[model samples]
Target: MSKKCSFLYGTLAVVLGIATSGSMVGSVYATDYSGSETIDLSADITDGIIIKSGANITLNLNGHTISTTESEDTIYVENGATLTISGDGEITNIAGKANIFNNGTVTINGGKITHAGSYYAILNHGEMIIEDATVTSTSEGNSMVVNGYYNYTSTDERIGYVEGKGIANPTMTINGGTFTGDIKNCIYKGDDGSINNISGGTFSGAAACVLQNVNEMTISGGDFTNNNSGYPVINNQYYDDEIDKGVVTIEGGNFTSADENSPLFENGDNSTIEISGGSYSLEPDEEFIVDGIGFNQQDNNRWEIDAPEEPETLPTVTEEQNPATADDILTTAGILATLMLGLLAIIGALGFNKRRA
Candidate 1:
């Protein structure tokens, strides 16, 4: 063989070897890591990992399990960066801290994410998404506490047990997967203003799904169960700005608020709560006013609950049957008399009715 041909064949063999060597192994890559890093996993990892900042990283796991023993956060993302986890992987943490915290964007396309966090299981500052994954949270068994400190003073609020200091009004959207947690406040959009939208998923939060001030909470389509103890599913209150009233809207979803109050509560008139679709049933004592829109559900599993643009009208049907009037009675008597006279004329012709009255 020629020397050039031999060299090409050797290069091809090297490439193929890397691809097939660790095909069934779990791995981690820190493509955007600029700071120092350390990784201690519960399972064996096949390939070495890198840490960089401002770069895209893909952490692939080959059916391996990674658990966090201590209270420290498992996955931490700083600066402006992106972290994507792929493959049949599982991340489990047994504390109140989240397995992943992204100051930028964190996407979990496929994996099993489990947490027993004392606080929030996963906190995102910028944007966070879970697609085609199973996220489960066990009982942290912590008491519900809601106290924020100001000038070394603490006041008790029924704040979310999971989320302590509310999030910075970040835009949080979930499209797919199962998320279960025993959280006081699953997502808190601090006083900075936030937008929360859930299109598709099976989300079950032990406490309120959202606790924020001056934020917009919108649920379109999903299997959501907010079985909290004290507050409603979406509760927003006590803000510095009068413009911080909360807006809770349920456009479409399979949602159930088991408590006596509503699954959603808008305290002042400034706070607006609208429900448009999915199965809705409040407690007997609680009433849902129709000041907003009606429930409209589609077969395709997509729904939206929003304020109507125009007013609605009642349906008109045909009138029902009633008793006969006075005019009908007079007309019937006259007809009977006419028939008698015709019969009498025929009898007179035959010499039968000769007496005249």
Candidate 2:
């Protein structure tokens, strides 16, 4: 062959080899899970994972990482499907819509999810259970949003209410994890019929640590802190309508506010908050008072109210009113000490009498 032809042929051969290798690498990294199956990540993936099948799917991270810059979600769970994450791994969304956009059930046992830009770390329109995980959002938006959809239409006669038309109401349960969203709410529930339960976690935010418009939330244990001045650590947006009422029960948690004047909780018009136990602290200010729409201190560690100025028909049960007397405790301790000393004296006398005999 001529010199020029030989050079062209060599270049073509090299191009073909590169193309073949690229295809092989793509095939090795790409993963599309469907049906009821479990997949373990063997290597770091660039392309996002999509779940189209309406079946239960399990993705084991296996200490790998999935990083993507695509506009789509890093992990998308379609409606009528379920996705469970197991093992330790990290999901990095550079500019995606969401790190995990769950329209179905998504359970995270162990993982690290980080999202940047305007999207949420987890936009849940279905059910989400974070047993153990770390979720962080650098965006100004919320870190986790449990949303419900409703449409209202007015007719000549009356207004019609349609439920479950757009996005289904979500139910989120956080047993143990760490959620950090410094700009907006760490967790937000937008509509009614949604349930949020946080048994254990650390939720920090610049605004409200948790905001619920019209929903029910039960917080047993967690550290909720609001770093900026906007709403309280837990805010229930006020609504005068009876149907738009929200309910919150703080069984146990540490709630703090950066601003001294800010209330640890802001109960809405018809909303109610029942605080059983939690450590709460605010900046020392004698003028500052704990006030809300319906605020009542039922006990030293409990507060309950339905709305402002509502009559307290129920009996007031306060720790101070019916407390254990210090004298009672001291008397019991003294009795126990006297019984022990009497026994010791009897034993000494028996030994002395036996030696003399």
Candidate 3:
């Protein structure tokens, strides 16, 4: 073929490729990964992502932003979808809608979620795990992570902060993250039958690091601080419930409050606070402390679980109950037998000497 014909053929192929590119725009558009593909955001998105069902997508922000000016979720996750957000990027919402409204499962492995809105940075009505991320709520009433409503009678009533939208099970696990907010909670759960697990995080709220209301919360580990003068680091409020089964079990954490008058933990209203383990800048109130558990207050004014004392044990001597073993008994018998034989020989020799004389 001639050079001109070859160039014309190449241009045709490029045009055909653009015409056949369905939803996979690669970088220009925020689309699905029907083949479980990773989409790197080459530019900031004004219109947010509404993930389709059964689509598992990994969106790498790549130091870009996924911001929306409209009053809609920045990332609307539908049911049966799994969205893994990674890279050092930003997800912000200028409107009143949530930055991330999850109805399926959303795992934030890394990113920054900041919002200047009336809603939460994350409004979850499904399973959400924040492994390592930063979520900041600047407004006084805005929160970092809030869960939608859940059906208490249904078995789907699981972990999350409830009070928004849903027919889905709300479960939020904060494994590792940096959450900060103003008057509202950095993390909160108020829904009936709500259960939240915060194993690791750095949470700081002007009001409370964790504002738990009438439910279960297992804070295995974290660093919590509250700047509010009236509220504690963990403010738990339990109103009257028919089941009477809501409990806040704080297994471990580092609690601190800038307000010296405020306690690290506050058993507000009718809440039951079971603190088996934690390190508090100040002492925990007697009502909140677990029974039979001791806290060691260090010189630095921090209080933690007292070191477990080792039980005094006697030294073991034999396989069974004995000071003298079988070997000791046998040796004693042999020595006695030898002495008797020697005595008998001496008597025999004396008798022989007398007879000889």
Candidate 4:
């Protein structure tokens, strides 16, 4: 064999062996897996992974691990791209943000996601929704954090601590799954919206579910537990300036707070708390006053929420016009005229009979 050809073949074999073994890693660029293909991260993916803009990427961990030891973000869902996870896989990042920005969604149907650093496990700015997923934060101090901003800012000084934050319009809808963390005022829904927790999953946090100056909070189902005492489970006090503007509706769920002051507080009269159904075990006080009905409980700890029947609407009545005494006199005059005509006719007939005799 020629010396040059033999040397080229030897180099190719060594490169192939490294790729086959799990020791060496691969640097997959954004364009490499942009199509409808699934990029399996079986090997160690060194450096930060950025699902660049304009790529509809499905990151199938394939039961692999994506570990990073850096202060920067490990996996970045850039503009217009998506990062979806399924099956028993894991995404681990310490000391950096798991940032999912503009128009991106981080959907985890099944897998274990650990965000251990001070950063958030899921930072959703655009639209983030979860179903049958497990999102956990092991960070001791604060497990999760999410912030949003208005599209524009007035002045640099006027810009508060959370100015120019995430998307102006961000949505967080948790339909099903389990989220375990000790969040502070961590989850921040924007001005026009709020966090909606429907049926399914478990949400446990030390701090209150802060609903600031925004719209209503409709929680139909789920399990919310606060082991702490005296602090309300949901605090609309953060929306002090716009207290009456904020509203909360809790139709169904199993809600509990270990502390006496842990009731869901409605700061203003307009800010209502309606309990249509679901079992709740809360030590109530003056601070935690719900405007609507409270969930009743039996002897056992199990709560019972009755299915509310629809309200019946009342029938409408029409009003009549006023009556006049003059109309009654007119009716009496007609009766008198008929009686006089009969008397005259009888006298005329008796006079005709006398003339004939």
Q: Which candidate has the top score in TM-score?
A: 3
The alpha-carbon deviation from the true structure for residue 197 of candidate 4, after best TM-score superposition, in angstroms, is: 4.7
lDDT of 4: 0.53
TM-score for each of the candidates = 0.56, 0.63, 0.74, 0.62
Best by lDDT: 3
Which pairs, if any, clash in model 2? none
TM-score-better candidate, 1 vs 2 = 2
Higher-TM-score candidate of 3 and 4 = 3
Candidate 2 wrong stretches, greater than 4 Å: 1-35, 142-144, 147-167, 185-192, 208-210, 238-244, 282-357
Tens digits of per-residue lDDT for model 2, 1-357: 444323322332343232332222212112232346566766666556555435576778888887655576777666667789989899888764777876678899998987777766676667889898887776775446545432223221111223331233467888998877655554555454556788888877655555555666788888777777656777675343433447777677777776666777766666767665556664212222234323344444333333346666988767688676779889989999999999999999999999999
Higher-lDDT candidate of 1 and 3: 3
**Candidate 1: segments with Cα more than 4 A from true spot:** 1-52, 139-169, 182-192, 205-214, 227-231, 238-245, 259-269, 283-292, 295-357
Residue 290 in model 2: lDDT: 30
lDDT of 4 by residue, 1-357 (tens): 344223322332342333433321322233443544355554544344555544565566667666555565656665456666566677677765663333365565666666776666665555566676666675544325342322224332112223233344455666777766655543333333334445666766556453332445567788767665665555542343331235656667777765555554435444545555666675333233355644455576655644477999887544345344677789889999999999999999999999999
Better of 2 and 3 by TM-score: 3
lDDT of 4 at 250: 64
What are the Cα lDDT values of the candidates? 0.51, 0.63, 0.70, 0.53
Q: State each model's C-alpha RMSD to the native.
A: 14.5, 16.2, 9.5, 12.1
User: Scored by Cα lDDT, where does model 1 land?
Assistant: 0.51
| Collision pairs in model 4 | 229-259, 278-305
